[model samples]
Target: MTNSLPEMAEIWQQTLNWQPSDHQQAQFQRLYHLILEGNRQLNLTRITDPQEFWEKHLWDSLRGIALKGEFITSLKEGASVIDIGTGAGFPGIPVTIIAPNCTITLMDSTRKKITFIETVLTELALTNAKTLVARAEEIGQQSKHRQAYDVALIRAVGTASVCAEYTLPLLKQGGLAIIYRGNWTEDETTGLENAVKQLGGVIEAIEKFTTPLSQSIRHCVYLRKVATTAVQFPRATGVPTQKPL
Candidate 1:
């Protein structure tokens, strides 16, 4: 049986004040097929059910960056974006399909996953996106990649502090990082504030929303880079997650 994702146009408009264009919708469908095929060999993702995949993987991924409809606008103006630890291309592929004007780099530590995403990009005919095989720690320090992105996206990667450390070092001044989380707490926010500050970033906003399909609580923490990060940032490999700022 071929699982088909729901084309909930009304829900997309109601929740995000946006709807996918015809080409984008078709691209999403093709992406679903590619991912399912890739899964057979690569263990791509656990979300195979169509509706569940639509809600959790596609919707949740976009929601992190869709603050009051700003994400769409930014992409329209051709922003540079990066997805750190983009397992199976979660938000990155969806964003690449929806925002054809923006350039997207999907970065992951695993060579096989990046290899799979490279296929996904080619199959989707996505010219504005690319794949990177490297850990966030190493990429954050590279002179070519450091402070190079206008937006950074991370989800299910690590603790908020570690996410901050990984993301902030790669953002240009005034760039934004969207950290996706399932549940959030004020205490966690307090801790994140200190961590972001140490990385030359500040908490711009934290939005809490419920999933339209499952009513699951979710949070998106927005961090803005206000100054240049110290060169010592991102530490060594595994340092961010082990010691976290």
Candidate 2:
């Protein structure tokens, strides 16, 4: 808790064309302290340093939605969003802070992680977010979750094709799936295209950028659902990883 988070208003504006309000910034600081406290018992995240957490977790998470100098308009208009495999609530929590109007569900298979996020929600008084302890494959097949969200976010979950399998099925027609990755390739895009097609989606865009602090390369693959995914999609539990797409 000694290392306080930086305001970095200029950096935020220059990088993402947006900056957190004072209340949101305070919530971000509180979230950081909660994560550090939770890490002692739970191993929540390795990036404990304030600057690193700000750059990698806070800034990096928000950057995924800031395309072409605009935050996705749907987010401001109260869209329903689900963050698949949201371990320790990276993009979802940051997103919930920024997009206060949108309703967010943070899904993770681990109950402990979900429990930690619930604590974060309560401590931050974030009324717009909720936590779900469930597998991606299971939720994608469930009636309540299938084709339910306007935006589906995933990061560091799996391969591109596998990510497509997990997210595409849960999105409504015309919904978007944002898959975050590091070190992308043309071969990977080809593989992803095939997978997304089978799941009733198309590759909308592939954005590449450099991390602000470390200057590391990152990619966000956007898939837009144009048709209903086959009922067989997402496969059985453990199947997406075992035999992706």
The parts of candidate 1 lying over 4 Å away from their true place are 69-72
Per-model clash counts, in order, read 0, 0
Poorest 10 consecutive residues of model 2 by lDDT? 65-74
What are the per-residue Cα lDDT tens digits for candidate 2 across 166-197? Answer: 99999999999999898899999899889999
Error of 2 at 96 (Å): 0.6
For all candidates in order, the CA lDDT equals 0.91, 0.92
**How accurate locally is residue 67 in candidate 1, as Cα lDDT from 0 to 100?**
85
RMSD for all candidates, in order, please: 1.1, 0.9
- Candidate 1, residue 116: Cα displacement in angstroms equals 0.7
User: After TM-score superposition, what is the CA distance of residue 91 in candidate 1 from its true location, in Å?
Assistant: 0.6
For candidate 1, give the lDDT of residue 185.
96
What value of lDDT does candidate 2 attain over all alpha carbons? Answer: 0.92
List, residue by residue over 1-245, the lDDT tens digit for candidate 1. 37777898998988888889888888888899998999999998999988989999999988887986546466778999999999999899999988888999999999999999999899889999988999999989999899999999999989999999999999999999999999999999999999999999999999999999989999999999999999999899988888876
